[model samples]
Target: MIGLANGCSATWHANRIFFLTVAAYALAVVFAASHWDIPLNLRIYSRPFLLFGFGVTVILFVVIATRVMLERPARLFPTLGRRLRGYDVVNRLIVGVPVALTLPVFFSLFTSMKNGLSRIVPFYADTTIVALDRAIHGGQDAWRVLHPVLGAGPLTFALNFLYNVWFAVMFVVLFCVTFSTGDERLRSRYLVAFVLTCVLLGNAAATVFASVGPAFVMPFYGNDTFFPLMNYLQATNAVYPVWAVDTQRMLLAYAALDGPRPGSGISAFPSIHVAVAMLNAIYLWRFSSLLRWLSVAFLIAIELGSVHLAWHYAVDGYASMLATPVIWIFAGWLSGLRRWPVAATAVS
Candidate 1:
C-alpha cells in the first residue's frame, strides 16, 4: 500500500492542473458574464450542484450498504462503519468536497458563457458548415440520408429520448468518477479531460465556429436550407412529442432574455453531446468490455440523434469523434500520470 505522504503527493499531482485550469476558466467566464451583464446566481446554479452531490452521496451509501448486507448480513453496520473510515472513503471525501465547490461554480459560468455567445460573436458558420456537410455526405445533407430510415414518428421520438438521456448519463459518469475508488491516475485524467472537452470544444471552438444548427438556420440566418428537416420534425412533434423542437424554442427564448438561465445556450459544430459520450466510452473501455460496447452504442446513437434531430451537422459529431481522443491523450499527458501497475491496489 502507498504511504500517506505518497498518496497526498499523488493527489496533489492529480488535481493540481485541474484546479489551475478551473481557476483560469472561472476568470474567463466572469469576464464574459460581465460583458453580457449576467450575474452569477449561486441560488440558480447550486441547485443542480446540491442535487448531484447529495444524489451521488446517497447512491454510494446505498450501494455500499447493499453490498455489505449481501455479503455479511449481520455485520452490515459494523462493516459500513469500518469502511466509511477507510482510506478509499477518505479519498472520495477529499475529491467530493472540492467537487462540491467546483461543480456549482462551473455550471453557473458555463451557462453564462453559453448564453453570452451570440452577444460575443454572431453565428456566421452555418452556411459554410452546410456546404461542408453536403460535401461530406456525397451531395446531400446528413439528415436526409438518415431520414429514409429514421424519419418515422416512433423512430424520431426514440432518438429524441436517447438524445435527452445524454444529460443524465453525463451526470452519472461525473459522480461516478468524482467518488470512484478506482485508479486515481485514470480518475484524474478523466476529470481533467472532461473539463477541457467542455471548455475547449464547447466554448472555445464553439465561439470560433458559431452556427445555429439546422433547427435554427431560418431563425438565425434566414436560410431555408434545412427547412425540410425542420418541417419534418415539427410534423413529427404533432404526433411524437419531439422535445428537441420545444427545447430549441426555449433556448432561443433564454438567449433573448437578459440573464442566463440554467441550460441556456446554443452551439453547433463539434457536438459536446457526442464529445462527452465518446469521452465516457474511452474512459470506460478499460474497466469492462460490456460497458465499453454499451458506451460505444450510446455514442453512436447520440451522434445519430445530433443529426437526425437537427441539433448538429454530421461533421459536428465527426469532429467530436475525432477530437475527443486527442484531448483525452493531451489530458493524460498534462496530468503527468504514468500507467498504474496492473497489480497495484488502486488508491483506497
Candidate 2:
C-alpha cells in the first residue's frame, strides 16, 4: 500500500487528487450497485469508450499533423518523431487513456445503479417540481414563454442541434482536461468539479428528488400538467427538427423494455445537462473570456432547450444553475488541499 501510494504520488503528482476522487467514486458506485441489486455489466462501457477513444485519437492526430506540416514542413518525419518522443505526448497518452477509460467504466456502473435505485424510490415529484417551475416563471409554462420568441423555425432547429451537441462537447472537454500536460492545477480542478457535479448533483440530488421531469410525467403518471407544452413541442417537430423528442421517446421505450441500461437513465429534477454545462462555463471563466461567454450562452440554450423540447421544467435548469457553482467551488477547495510538499517527498 505504501509503495502504491508513493508511486501514485510520484507519477500523478498534484493530479493525484483526481485519481483519488475517481477511486472514491468507483467505491461508491460499487456500494450502490450492491445495495440496489443492480447487475454490473462491463460491456455497457464498450461503445462509449470506443467512441471517446476514436474522437480523441483523430483530434490529436490532426493537431499534431497540422503542427508538423506548418512548423517543420521540410522535416515532417523528424518533427513527428520528436513530438512523439516528448514527455507531454507520452504522458498524455499514458495518463489520458486510463483516465478516459475510468470515467465511462465507472460512470456507466453509477448510472445503472442510479436508474435501478430510482425505480425503488417511493414516488415521483413531478407535481412539486412543476409547481416550482410555475412559481419561478410566474405561473407560465416555460415553453410557452420561449415558443413566442424562438418559434418553430430555423433558430429552434439550430438550438436543438446545439442541445444534442452537448454530449460531444462534454466528451471533448473531458478529453482536453484529462490529456492536458500544461496545466496540472487547472486539470485537477476541472476533473474534481466534473466528478463531483455528476455524483452529487446528477446522482445524489436526483435520487433525493426522485422526479422524472416534464417529459416522463404524463407517461409515468398520466398527468396532463405539461400536456400543452408537449403539444407545442410536437407541433414544432412537424415544421422544424427537435432531437429531444426522439431522445425522450427512446428513453421512455428503454425504461419500459429494459428498466435501466448503460447509456439510458431517467431523472429530471436538476438537469445534469444544464449542471455540466454550467460547470464547464464556470471553469472556462477562469481561462478564456470568449470561451467562457460561449459556454454560458450554450448553457442558457441548454436551459431553454430543456424546457422548449419537453425534457425538463424551467426550474430544473434553474436548480442546476444554482447547485453547480457551489459544487465547483467545493471542488476547487478540495483540489487545493493536495499536499505538494508531501507528494514531492514521497516521490523523491
Residue pair clashes in candidate 1: 87-348, 88-348
What TM-score do all the candidates reach, one by one?
Answer: 0.89, 0.90
Q: What is the lDDT of residue 119 in candidate 2?
A: 53
Each candidate: RMSD:
4.1, 2.9
List, residue by residue over 197-264, the lDDT tens digit for candidate 2: 88888888888888887778888899887787677777778888877788889888877754457668
Residue 256's C-alpha lDDT in candidate 2? 70
CA shift of 344, model 2, Å = 0.5
Task: Report lDDT (CA) for all predictions.
Answer: 0.83, 0.78
Per-residue alpha-carbon lDDT of model 1 for 172-263, expressed as tens digits?
A: 88877876656766877888899999998998889899888998888887889889898999999998889999999998887677767888
lDDT: worst 10-residue window of model 2: 339-348
**Candidate 1 lDDT (Cα, 0 to 1):** 0.83
Query: What is the Cα-based lDDT of residue 337 in candidate 2?
Result: 81
Which candidate wins on TM-score? 2
- For model 1 the local lDDT of residue 76 reads 64
